[model samples]
Target: MTETEVLAVAGQQAIWACLMVGGPLLGLLLAVGVVVAILQALTQVQEAALAFVPKMVVLGLALMFGGPMAMSVLRTFTEDIFAQMVSVGGLR
Candidate 1:
């Protein structure tokens, strides 16, 4: 591929990798936040901790469980970049 085409492909792959790594966590947080908001609205308990605690707990749990998958995505991206570099004569 030409240099520009290669760069475009790399950028697309990078974006895809980022979404794969972050999408689940963000989606979970969105769902949790919405539920918490609805609950807070219904019960009329507007404590700052109420909103923050669940997100934090969920984020921690997600990281613990999702770290391996995130790492795998990153590793694969790094390998693809290196392989592309070799193919494009940018690496020995």
Candidate 2:
């Protein structure tokens, strides 16, 4: 592939990787925020901690569990990019 074409593909792959890695954690935070907002409305609890704690806990867990998989994906991407760089004469 031409260098421009290869770079475009690599850029697309990196964007996809970001979405996959962040989608779960962002989804969890969204769900938790909605729940916390509803609960606050029902009980008039205005404490920021109430809204913050669950999202933090759940997102932390998501990262803890998915961190390895995310790292693996990223590492593989890096290796591929470097390989391509060498192939395209960008690296020696």
Candidate 3:
């Protein structure tokens, strides 16, 4: 495979990695936000800061749960890119 092919593969892999890593956390954040909004509406408590803590906590937990997988994906991508780079001619 040529350098361009390697790079294209790596780029696509990176994009996929990002989506895989980020999707859950983003989805959770959205869910939390919606729930908080609904609660605020029902209770009529317009405290802006109320949403902050729960979202942060949920997002943090999501990241903690997902962190290992994310790191593994990133490591694999980095290793692949490096292997390709070595095969393609040692950093040009």
Error at 39, model 1, angstroms: 0.7
Give me the candidate number with maximum lDDT. Answer: 1
Arranged by lDDT, best first: 1, 3, 2
Estimate the lDDT of model 1: 0.96
Candidate 2's TM-score? 0.91
Q: Assess the local accuracy of residue 56 in candidate 3 as a C-alpha lDDT between 0 and 100.
A: 98
Name the 10 consecutive residues with the lowest summed lDDT in model 2.
83-92
Give a tens-digit lDDT track for model 1, residues 1-92.
98889899999999999999999999999999999999999999999999999999999999999999999999999999988888888644
Off by over 4 Å in 2: none
Across 1-92, the per-residue lDDT of candidate 2 in tens digits comes to 99899899889988988888888779889998999999999999899889888988998898899899989988988998888888888644
For all predicted structures, in order, the TM-scores are 0.94, 0.91, 0.89
Estimate candidate 2's alpha-carbon lDDT, on a 0 to 1 scale: 0.88
Q: Per-residue lDDT tens digits of candidate 3, residues 7-60?
A: 898889889988988888899999999999999999999998998999999988
